[model samples]
Target: MLNRLFLPSIFALLIYGFWVSAEFKVIAAGVAVFLMGMVYLEKGFKLYTGGLLENILKKTTSTLFKSVSFGLATTSLLQSSSLVSVIVISFLSAGLIGLETAVGIIFGANLGSTAGAWLLAVFGLKIDLSSYAMPMLVFGLLLNTRAAKPLKGMGYILIGVAFLFLGIHYMKEGFDKFQSSIDLSAFHIDGIYGILVYTFLGAAATVIMQSTNALMVLVFSALAVGQLDYVNSLAIVIGSNIGTTVTTVIGAIGANAQGKRLAAAHLLFNVVTAIVGVVALNPLMVTVDEIATLFGIHPHDYTLKLAIFHSLFNIIGIALFIPFIKLLVKWLKSLFNDSYSKEPLNLAKIDESSMERAIYLNPAVLSYPDAAMRALTKESGRLYRNTLELICYGIYFSGEQLRNTDNLSELAENWEKEEQPWSIKGLYIRHIKGIYADIIHFAGALEGNLPRQQAQELFALKVACRNFVQAIKHVKHIYKNMGKYIESENDEIRHQYNQLRLCLASVLKLVDILGVRRNYNHIQEHAAQLKLELHEQDQQTYSTLNKLIRSEQVDSYMASSLLNDSAHVHDACTNLIDGAVIMITRDREEYREYDLAGFTPAAQKTSS
Candidate 1:
């Protein structure tokens, strides 16, 4: 059993068992089971946060209203607002939108999400589209086998559209039959508790369905068929808001601090809004009723009014909270803060929470690397400052902080055990891997829409950063393993470390060129000169390895490992600068520079 197949089989079997136990009809049970499966699938799809945002932007580029329609339609087609919200959240986290701008988009997303509801309300109640679903699915299956790109895309669209209508049809039929036989006519309950129960139901449904759109459609169909009322529907809507957070929460679980933050923000927004909604239920519901009546609509007209209310609540919430975003953010920080954590967090990860936090940080940094670098420098400084504070606590206030001499002894033992040279070596290995990956990504991005000169400059900076990662790691390694390693015998390690520092210095000089705007010629000249210097340094580092090893003062493994690490660092730096050169020299018809001698043939390939 393949890993993916095993879970779906188990889920199907479990759902079959549940449907039989729940006394649900076969069709209703099938729909319920499929929805359960959909939730898991949508959650998996949400991992590509960046690509999702790009698609959202692509769909929304024409006009704001059209964009909203496109968003709604696309989400309806996809059957996942959590997916759409995820894209929106990523854009927000990436600083693609300001707080005020994001407020509207978030509102738009809420509106767009209602498309599925409208579809279900109209089609589920008035028409039977389930008959076409099988044909559409079959057609899609055929199209998927075609070699053409357009055919494949159409195939996907057909399949998605078919599944969506099929799901709606199944849900409607289930509820209609369930309603006719089982009397769920009315239950007199307290307003707040009723709202809470309905909201919880909505949340649970959305979570199980893995889609707010699905729940919205269910609510719409249920109301259209008169199985549920406005108050109950409204409560479910609020619950759907809470349940939607589950996708992002799951997305951020193993992700970095930034991812966690975005997920947290999403959870916070839904939970807070739901709570406030519960508190304001009576007045808000009345207001909705009054507004609907004023528009010459019946109080019982659930579809139009439901959509209106969903839009209204989110819009009002966004408006009311926009000005107090900073305060809300501060509150979130206080709420989430833990005194024991050592790692710093990226607030952008709380992307789904609000635009204020998500839409202003990452894009700013990625768009303007200089600004990002400055910000990173400041952050690095802060990290070091915190480290210094900890060091002070260990030094001056050691006795007081430790509480007892035995405790101090325990702390020392723990430090010796936990912070060993092996751990430092592991960090070094991880950093080296990251440097290579970053360089490759930088090269690929340079080959795209960026101007030749700009590409080169970026390439130079990437090279410098790679060198910096190596040099910093070497410093950590030396500081940790200094007592054990023989400096006289380990001259190879010392010389390699020195060469690494020199490479860093060259990178710093090249980075200076990248700090401000410059034309292609200037960027090219700087990159070429820097590459030459780096090549020379690489040669020097490699040349000294034999001399240092012949002395036999240190073990061969350590000496050879140090040399190999140096070579890796050298390659990373050289590749970065070379990538810049390719970007800069690419546009020229007959360029004079081709410094391919330093690179291995495998590494010489560039996009341009």
Candidate 2:
């Protein structure tokens, strides 16, 4: 409802301002062009995100100080704290960094953003940058026409910088011209009430612009032209700092609970900083004056003074929060628990309609490659677990029975006495199909910004999910005759069906063990053993079937069913083992090293 009215109202205001004064029109145009530059700048930086940024974050965010330094460096380089915030949120959602580390990064980003104010105050206001804008735009346009993505990204950045300079020029000239017609200084108020009012106005401007850096540029330009008072500018700076968290809050809307907690931390940091700045305004201003004098800045240079205050207040906020990082993390965790922490695998209360929703895929993580890949891999694991459960139920066994590490033959024999039956088709639709579809859809939707190796990992996980579902489908084919044969009057056929049950159950148990194993060498050795055992079981079943048929222990009807079911069992076992290998093996290179070790004839014969 607000959006419907707000947009038209802004348009109407723009139309009226343009009709009222040419200077007002120029200022508005300057603001628009500046905003466009900000958009392009963010776009250019985003092109470099997936791998390089992810690696930097992983290497640098190990300690709180390092996280803060990384955040400061990144925000200073990008000139977009909002982008940094979104990246941090994505990292937290992806489990790339802890909440405490994320909070530290947010703290550092606030201090880093003050550099924008310093740059604008010291250089932007003093130089005639518009003189260089035309050449930059020309070069940027030529570079944009190139086919390479990095070159195109560089072009956008150049164009963005040019537009920003041009906008600053226009805004400065427009404000200077407008000053002759009306005195903005006459409207300026003094004291605490004035600070409160101007701070609120500053926050409103930032919320409307959605970029505090842009707001700072505008404020500096206006201050240079003697249109804004230093005291009110400082108040607006405080408000803008608090308002900057809106971007993170918006980004966190689709994020997991951890992302939301990081957003909350961002808001808390900014709000606390604003409150501190407001409460200690007098003492801070005095210190800023002293610092300005010590640094050889003129008292009349309000733009530089504002920059000093911006940095000083943000540094104070960081200092205040650094000691309480653990407490803040504890509070955030207490406020927001993991969304998927509930009973994810409760079979008794399965909601058929809820299968379409993703269990691990969060759109917020897509901005960071590491986070996005982790989400895909985790969701694939969930799908694999669900497939295992469905396969167990299809074979007239409970998931519990499949997971049990007790004597497999005794468990299978005991489960055979139970008459429980389930619909494989129904379970597939309710449990497997929807999750499989979601996993494929989610994996396909990943941004093309991932590193080649990570992209391959994502593809491998998708293939693993496909193999898991296919294995379950194979079990469904055998399920039709499984219960019938296991209870048949012929002891030979019944025993063979029981053997098939035990063989598949053993494969399931081995896969579960593989899931928990951490050592790369142990995983490889165990996975090879599992492959050899399955192959041996397949050969033993085939030999037993052939012997029973030759001895006339099994008639043609029984032989045909057993033969077809034996093939289905082999396919199911092979698919399950392949999928489990992909899921458990973290390093493809290690798996490659050990893959051929298990296929040797000597090892195979010894296992058999």
Candidate 3:
């Protein structure tokens, strides 16, 4: 509703302004071009999103100071606090960085925005950026036609820069022309109400324009042309600072609870900063003038003074809040609990039509490769858990038995005297197929955009999904026999079947250990060791089968059934081990090709 009401109202105002004064067209054109440039700029940056920026954000956000520096630097380069804020929101949603880190970045971005003010005031207002803009636009559009992604991204960035230049030029020219027709100084008011009114106007304009950098350009250009009072423009700056959070707030709407918490923190920081700037308005202005004088800025050059004031305001805000970040984070966590988390669904209870879907795979996280990659891995882990559950229930091994260190031999035994075993095939279609398809579809959509490292990571996830399904298929193939013979009247077959169950339970136990532990070397160690154990188990099972057949303790038919079922058991073990390793391990190394663990299951023939 705000979008609907706001856009039409803005258009109406622009149209009326154009009718009243032709200069309004040039100003409006500048804002439009500037906004378009910002869009291109953000897109250009995002094109490189898969690994480069994401890895940096993850590593650098370890401390409050580092997070703030990253925010400030990126916002300075990007030239739009709004874009920076939104990107931070996406990062937060992906679970890459914490709320404290995110808030630090946002606070720093406010300071970074002042860099744009300094550039515009000192250079943008005085120089003919239009000349530079023309060449950039030409070069950018030409490169944009290239097929390579790097070239395309550079082109978009150039075009964005060009548009920003042209925009500033047009706005300056418009205001210059407007000074002759009407003195905007006449519209300027004084006192507390005036300060409040102008501040609100600045914030409202920023929210509507969706770029505080653009709003700053407008304010600076208008002030340069005597169309705005220096004090009034400063008030607008305060408002613009508050309004910058709008972009983050909007971005967070579709994100997870973590994203919303970060957005709230951004809003809180800016609002508090605005309040400080307002209450200390006179003193800050005095300080700005003093700083301006110290730096040899002419007394009449309010634009430069405004830049100093902008930087000072944010600096003061950061200084005031940096110490309390931990406390703030604790409060935020209390305020925004993880109520978004869903209750774990029982695989046995799910309807085939309404099988589980991806939890972490949301459209909001897809904007950044790092976020999307993390989310994919997380969702795959969830699927792995569900598959484990289905495998346990299908084979008549109690799920609860796998939780602790009860003897594997004891846990492996089928405790149920009489119970309905879930159909493994039914569980696959009902629980695995839909979620697997969703993961596949999501991964497919992200194929080309990722860097080699990120792409490979994404591929690892797909392979894990396939292997998981393959594991299920192997279980499904042997499900009926395992259920029938676990309590068979024949002692030899029952003991052998229990041994097969123990083999599976052992592998499941390692997988459970991998899931809980975060030590990578230990995971690799355990995964390699499990493969060895499965290989040993395969040899032992073969020997036992031969012994049973030769002694005639089991019939030829039972021997043949055991032979076929053993192969299925071996394949299933291989699948679970390999798949679990891939799902958990970040560095795949050459371990994925360990022995015969990468065996292609019979499910490979199906049109998955």
Candidate 4:
């Protein structure tokens, strides 16, 4: 288990070592020092989930501006865009903030990343910080051995700082050997091709290393040796911005609709920023050079220029795009639809009537919410299969017969009408709700240092399950009443049944999101829509109850029961939407007022 868990971290370390060079080493060491300082400044994210930070931000002139600033600070310290993105996603899921607010925070993360580049530039220039790095490492290890609280924190900080510098030292050693032997200056470049090649290389390196800081070091190495110039490196930094999105894109693979949508949005933000950098490169470079000259520095090294251009271009990109954020949201919605298929259709399989024999069907019992979500996700997928089979078998209740009809409508109808064993459905529904609660529990068990959005998604899953239960009950009730007075020729039994079915199906679709897809937005919207449908059905139920009572068709006791069930369904749907909304909303006050905190499940009773 330890090996499995640490494998990724080991890979990250190996990659860092492989790609880092001597010029880059100075940059890396500086980044480590700065990161240590940031950890001290924030006191190691004491009130994480961004509450304290969010509060500080809200007091600023603009909430959006504040969020961006916070995002930058947080990401700079964390050094992992994936970690930051997960936090943003979690915040949206937890109902601590809105999607727009989260988006702004993410934008800030891009800017915050320039901190790494600046650190690299600073260290590259100083070239003497290495002497103290070893001392810091030795003292840090000693302090860590003691149990004193403050010393321990400082010790951990020192250790991180030491490793970072050590990594940089090794990296610089690697670069030094190449600089002495290699003659990059002899291989001069034509202007356009030079810029394009180096720029593309920067982007490629960032994508491969998954760190802009690491990529900046590579550029610094080239600058340290008179190989690549500043303007070209800046171009590469610009391209790195675009390339960073590839990780988020890969993370979204096989995710539900919402995850894919957010991934696309992240890609758009980076690519658009890259374009902005391209357009303003010459102007930005001149401005930086003018400043460097004022400070009596030649700015001969293009590495600093790359850093300057990176910060300016990102700021400019944010300035140009911030106001039109809503437009971007709208564009994202238009570009991707829920029905958009990400996977190829599986055609070669068992016959339709042998669905139970299909690999998709299994007898495994679900013990956790994740397990239940997995189960329900598989079950929900049958909706499409069932519908297609119905069409293929000519199973419509209408009089008209199609040219391709083999009169399989009877077969389809029987299959549809066959009452799914109550125990089976009950176990499934129980698992659904169980898994929902488990998700929340698992999130809560996690270290609180995690972002707020992460916690709220777990809660949202719980809400979604509650809503699913109501939908299932409503459908079962309708099925029970179908052959009675509710099913008369003139009655709208079929319509009511259809409403229940749609709500239930929607709930099932949502289960896929919670299962493993991690698409919070897609599940959230669908949850809200399902609730609205359930609400409408409640009204219809009331209307039906009044008519039944007027004609004495349904006795008082039966009418009362039906009304209760209808109301329960309505409430269930409302709860699901509320839970999802809390997951998505930015305003903590809104969720607090709803008191969803009351909805949390009790800890599982352990066996004696």
Number of the predicted model whose lDDT against the real structure is largest? 3
Candidate 1: residue 442 Cα off by (Å): 14
Candidate 1 to truth, TM: 0.59
lDDT of 3 by residue, 1-608 (tens): 87689779877988899899998888999999999999999888877765778788878878889999999998898887777787777767656677888898988888998999989988999999999999999999998999888999999999999999999999999999988888889999898889999999999989888889899999999998788998999999999988888888888887777788888888899999999999999999999888988989999998989898999999999999999999998988888776333544454444445555664565666677777888788778778877887787767755555775568876555376445545676667767787798799889887676766667667777888888888888888888889888878999999988888888877887787776785566775676677777788879888988998899899998888888888888889888987887776744554333222343322221312
Off by over 4 Å in 1: 1-23, 26-52, 55-79, 88-108, 131-135, 186-190, 294-299, 333-507, 515-525, 530-576, 579-608
Residue 488, candidate 1: alpha-carbon lDDT: 31
Model 2, residue 564: distance off in Å is 3.8
Question: What shift in Å separates residue 546 of candidate 3 from its native position after superposition?
Answer: 9.4
lDDT of each: 0.52, 0.80, 0.82, 0.53
Give the number of colliding residue pairs in candidate 4.
Answer: 17
Better of 2 and 4 by TM-score: 2
Q: What stretches of model 3 exceed 4 Å from their correct place?
A: 1-3, 339-359, 393-403, 413-438, 451-457, 473-493, 511-571, 581-608
Q: Poorest 10 consecutive residues of model 2 by lDDT? A: 595-604
Arranged by TM-score, best first:
2, 3, 1, 4
Regions of candidate 4 where Cα sits further than 4 Å from its true position: 1-62, 93-95, 139-156, 254-258, 294-296, 338-608
Rank ordering of all candidates by lDDT, starting from the highest: 3, 2, 4, 1
Cα lDDT tens digits, model 1, 402-493, are: 32233333343243212222233443343234334434453454345333444443444344344444444444433433323323345556
Question: Estimated TM-score per prediction?
Answer: 0.59, 0.85, 0.83, 0.54
Model 1, C-alpha of 522: deviation from truth (Å): 5.1
